[model samples]
Target: MKIKALLAASVAGVMFAGSVLAGTLDDVRARGKLNCIINTGLAGFAAPDDKGNWQGFDVDFCKAVAAAVLGDANKVSYTTATGKTRFTKLAAGEGEILSRNTTWTFSRDVDLAQTFIGVNYYDGQGFMVPKKLGVKSAKELDGASVCIQTGTTTELNLAEFFAGNNMKYNPVPIETNAEAQELYKAGRCDVYTTDASGLYATKMSFDNPEAHVVLPEIVSKEPLGPVVRHGDDQWADIVSWVLRAMMSAEEKGITSKNVKKLAAQDNKDKEINRLLGKDPLQGLSKLGLSADWAVNVISQVGNYAESFERNLYPLTIVRGMNALYKDGGLHYIPPIK
Candidate 1:
């Protein structure tokens, strides 16, 4: 009788663990695709082409996650979420992950019941103005009419920047980036402000890109990355590691073009071998992914650096803070082993 009781207890514990793991991974597999939330329409970040195919840095992150989970990068459905709706959509389980350019704020992590995962983009708030305005510095834009997106940190930052300079300005608040761009271009506002990277994207989309100049001052820290729901740890691990895999691939000189060849070769670097699945990646099977998960990511979506160069670099923005830590940037990744 004592032996039977012990056996039953052990079986029950194993069943419980298996049940929990299946709850998250099984749902994704059963659905046949990953639901990823992205920006509404920010160029070089998340935007749909004329053929309705999503393409950008944030879009690549979603594709990488899909590849890690489904072994097919194309198996992802993207949902567009604005600044006001991104968090709510994730909390409601509208998507498994959010790859929008969302900042990792303290309140957002603990109070909002979400995990930020990691920072993919190190950004700062900045302002942009038309060259016709002749504004040499952010401080010189005193009493200027400013166009800012509502429901973003930019509104608050704009207030503080102007106040800190002991100046007052008229604020023209809008809901979306398109609206803000219209207001600024139509002369309703003298300046527009947002993330510095966003400023570059917006200016590049203008009729004459040379007409606008982004201010030199950077005001706030905006560490942007992917996010997942709070309750599902297994799902979070899958998504978080997908991002880290991209960053790690970039760090180790693995790219889309070289991924297949490198995966076929034996190397002395244990981390690289394990990451490319030459050796067993211990935690991957537990995450409901194959040992070749990083291989799927690099082959499909490329590395972090590839995604950036393809999307943002074409717009002429420099990779100032987005470079790997070894390359004088902040893109550090955890070891796969």
Candidate 2:
């Protein structure tokens, strides 16, 4: 009966693993706060305000998930992680969700055992240089010293772009955006390379922001989004739909200013009613969230447009690829109903 014993032990191990995988929601609920991992300090994406409050495009998504699950957007605790430590912290369960400006890729999704919920920002790698440098294009930087963050897709993209152009340059590797900014400003590197959106954010933080100009060329696509650990289907769905709900709310004209009022009445739009919990939508109970979850998210954090305009607009970041689908952008979301 040795074979029988081995099969029994195997079944027991599977059950234990399933239980662990299924406990993310329960764990958050029990903890009474959602631990969200964010960037150390990437201005428009995730940075502390003068008053030490975390506010940005990525921070809002974490708050939205907190609102949807815990019924309070402010019930989230933030943990700062550098690019090199983000995935390791997530995989180790140090944080429930990683809302840093992380790019989604095949290896991160499959090999690392993590799930990227959806793309919050469509970005591309670009270069920024001082106007005094007189370099208008990235191609002109043949032998330039490029300041790039370590452990990012931008690093790989930079290498490939330079190699493809048959050029060589000195690499000034750094760990954080703030470090890169410091070194670039001190003339340690001739060029600063990162996502185009990030370039704007970095520029805005400078003393004389107008002195720097981002080049026109976008070298590689950077689909940035929120991430969670793999093997938790329920937690993944909850986070995924939290983002989708914000997009759907924007598509349906449900802004934070009017979400509560609209939720009180039965509108002609059945989808709106369903989203605001006037009518029941199936499968939400399985995710262990309330019927008014979408309402909480919309009312607290607002739609995707609101978050972007509030955080990125001040940095002069226009919604190029981040605009709605009907508005000729890539932010199309599936129906909430």
Candidate 3:
């Protein structure tokens, strides 16, 4: 009976695997576009502009994938999802890739059956309070009402922080950043907590930005990046390598402004040559992308550094821990060859 049960489980696994492998590349090709899920709205991450064009750091990653596959960065349909719905949408096959500012956590990585492609933003949970509250530190916020997003690492992190500090506070849980911002502005919550970068973006969106201040406490590591369903190895490789290509492009000093010109330059550096597909970006073509996939990504979306500075710098989120490892931070890419 035990052996029969084991055989049944094996057959079920194989059937599940077969269904998942059923031609995502062909679907994308036939649709002539890539469907990418992004945050409902987060400045410097995945928010749409006044013209309804999606543009931000995360948005660029999606465009990079689209460019690498379809040879056109604009060949993408952006689906906006909140924290509570992003994973469910992705798992339901609502989108090919989710480029929202999602953190890489143990449960989400292993138990949740999702593949975090790479860390595009290294962040931490922080608190933002009204300057008038006279609270200079997160430690002082005992019994305070904190606005937090439900269905996020922030929720767990907030609980751990308060428990560790031996403090009690009211949690005003909301579904989206927009709702949280409203609750915060209405004085419904004493503090708004999320990733440090997200807090900055939210604070800046307020009418009187100077009235709110982000505390210096970073409670949890929130390494935000792209993700996809776990079963598709081909899709995972395509997304993973796109992010790596961007990071490596930044490390190698290849920017969108000069990518075309640089692509025509000599192959003095083998790494650069391999990355730009000037000399076979090595096994990347097997993923159904052109030899110049990296070139297309760099030219269309710019390097990782460029994308960050474009959206994040404006909100005062400097490149501190998010900088490449060679530049004295923790950003590193796997080898192209």
Candidate achieving the largest lDDT: 2
From the highest TM-score down, the ranking of the candidates is: 2, 3, 1
Arrange candidates by lDDT, highest first: which order? Answer: 2, 3, 1
lDDT tens digits by residue: candidate 2, 1-337:
9999999999976654542355899999999999999999988999999999999999999999999999999999999999999998887777899999899999999999999999999999999999998998889999999999887898899999999999999999999889899999999999999999999999999999999999999999999999999989899999999999999999999999999999999999999999999999988899899999999999999998999999999999999999999999999898876
Worst 10 residues of 2 by lDDT: 13-22
Q: Model 3, 62-129: lDDT tens per residue?
A: 89999888889999998998888888778777789989889998899999899998888899999999
Pairs with backbone N, CA or C atoms under 3 Å apart (clashes), candidate 2? none
Which lDDT value does model 2 have at 112? 94
Deviating ranges (above 4 Å) for candidate 1: 1-22
Candidate 2 Cα outliers beyond 4 Å, as residue runs = 1-20
Local error of candidate 1 at residue 312 (angstroms): 0.5
* Candidate 1 residue-wise lDDT, 168-258, digit = tens: 9999888889889998999999999999988988998898999999989998999998998788888888888888889888888999999
Top-TM-score structure, candidate number? 2
State each model's CA lDDT, in order: 0.87, 0.93, 0.88
**Decoy 1 TM-score against native:** 0.92
